[model samples]
Target: MRLKNCHNFKDFRKLAESRLPGPIFNYIDGGADDEVTYRNNTSCFDKCDLIPNVLRGVESVDMSVTVMGQKLDLPVYCSPTALQRLFHHKGERAVAAASEKYGTMFGVSSLGTVAMEEIREKHKNPQVFQFYFHKDRGLNRAMLERAKAAGVEVLMLTVDSITGGNRERDLRTGFSIPMQLTLGGMMQFAMKPMWGINYVTHEKFRLPQLESHVDMSGGATSIGRYFTEMLDPTMNWDDVAELAEFWDGEFCLKGIMSGADAKLAADAGCTGVILSNHGGRQLDGSSTAFNQLTEVVEAAGDRLDVMMDGGVQRGTQVLKALSLGAKAVGLGRYYLFPLAAAGQAGVERALGQMRAEIERDMKLMGVTSLDQLTRSNLRFR
Candidate 1:
């Protein structure tokens, strides 16, 4: 299928699969070993049914939400993922522009292809810098300073990825930073010549965020190695507290899945805590964010914003999370697939569709504003 024919997440995913190379597409599609949690993230939504109210005059809808400290036109924002340029030549630039047009927050990954400074200079919308705590404290502090200098509105520390997950797809495809693809993988890339052409014709791929400190050249460092060797496995509440103090702004902890941990984040001065499992990219069989939303929200919702990511494909899913008490939701592969399919335009199309879905679903549910949604609107099956 083509971008024009894509109307939903699955359609965009199909187009992306057809256009992108196997390794690249799988990078965005695949989760941890077995992918049980990855599949369950969306499946859990099926357990609960929305009880819509009729005969209400719903002429207009307001989907705006303020999470962390930024006001978002939509309840959903783009969560940061690594190596966007590999998925599409436009990379973070495409995602950033689309988020700006949609008036939502866009996260810049520590492994993002575009520089935070450049994106900050280009986009006027709220931006978040998603990074990890490194073994080198000095490096972590410096990166925080850099983000502060760039005027990033949020600092999201990904606490779950102390180490990389067992992504068997990458192992099978032999996918790495420098790309030591197996013979079969090489054939897959060769099959998609258009992707290769665009990849080669564009500027050389580089992780601008880590290029200054990490030597990623000539396969000297792989992402797996970076996580295993560089990231601090000993990161604790103390470390997070220190970082939050240094950030001293809209700070949040991504990858938080437990109520107690969410409370700790609130006590540590976090402005928000994202109920995420790294999009099921880490820890197979872990609880989906949707499944853990209520616990996290109850524990810290009054203290700080409780947001969630993973398995958010439909607008109804966004509403369900909001009704359950999530201040906002995050999109990962939802927009990435569209980006891979048609670059910037594809992303905008996906965002526009999502906006429409939320608006229409809101009116149908007899709610004009997000505040009207409550736990009473849901019935668990």
Candidate 2:
């Protein structure tokens, strides 16, 4: 019911559901068409079992991992999501601060409500600029240059989402930027007066990430248009390679789901590849990232730091991904729901719980450090 009561992902989700309006909650909860991929993202983890070797005299646990040249205290980082301010007034501010406290990396989306520069100035942790290849080549170059100037440590280009997925939940609820809410959607907002009050009472809502380049006023651009009209559907390895060369730092691909593509990412000079399906928000019935981690790791793990983000709900799940050779994992809704339930406090609690879970699970698994995990520590069902 409250922040303190929120002990895990499901707890945070429950709290978020209680606090947020119907349309807003569904936006975070829903995925592509039937959401089968979204459900499987977590369910796939069930097929893989963690074979812990107990009684190894494990006392203190070290769960640190280095990915994309950033050393993270925990193996999990907050995967970027858009419209955080709408979920909680603190927006990306809370997420940035919490991730810093945990000594891990956190990403800020191109559609993030807060500016990357502002977050950069506040925290010393490695920050990611989640880039989207746009139709305007100049805009793309400018955005990359801007992040370069701001000193972002990593460039995570989301390759899968050339266009937005078919999210039917938004259609039913009428959730949009300026809120062309249907009668039912308006009523849902009316019921959550506290959220509205907090929203209005705090800073005015605006996507500082894209306000300068994109005109969002007068209902000109919603997420739908931003994807269909603005993003470049012609994006390819050449484009990604050029961007990686331009960055000339730690560059990662976020939507790669196949081993061949992971190999191409390595050949393209990418430092890392994250097996993700856009949290099942883009493509439905796609293979879960967890299911594809082994193939990817086998194909490109030697050359590129292979990571994944999907359907991870517990510390054991994180361990499972690591056992399969994921350099790290990214957390999306696991942190967003808590951000919605509370503000910085909520995020901090969620990260704290995750750290504790990882540590506890590591000790229980009879491992003192992350290197102790291996494919030998797993049994596939």
TM-score of each: 0.98, 0.97
**Can you write out model 1's per-residue Cα lDDT over 54-155, one digit (the tens) per residue?**
989999988999888799999999999888998999999999999999999999999999999999999999999999899999999999999999999999
Residue 147's C-alpha lDDT in candidate 2?
Answer: 91
- The lDDT values for all models are 0.92, 0.90
Per-residue lDDT, model 1, residue 165, is: 89
Residue 262 of model 1, lDDT score: 88
* Superposed model 2: Cα runs more than 4 Å off: 219-225
Clashes of each: 0, 2
Q: Tens digit of lDDT per residue, candidate 2, span 259-354? A: 999999999999999999988999898999988988999999579999999878899999999998999999999999999999889989988998
RMSD of each: 1.1, 1.3
Candidate 2 Cα lDDT to native: 0.90
Candidate 1 lDDT: 0.92
Output candidate 2 Cα RMSD: 1.3
The list of candidate 1 runs beyond 4 A from truth reads: 219-225
Q: List the residue pairs that clash in candidate 2.
A: 41-311, 42-311
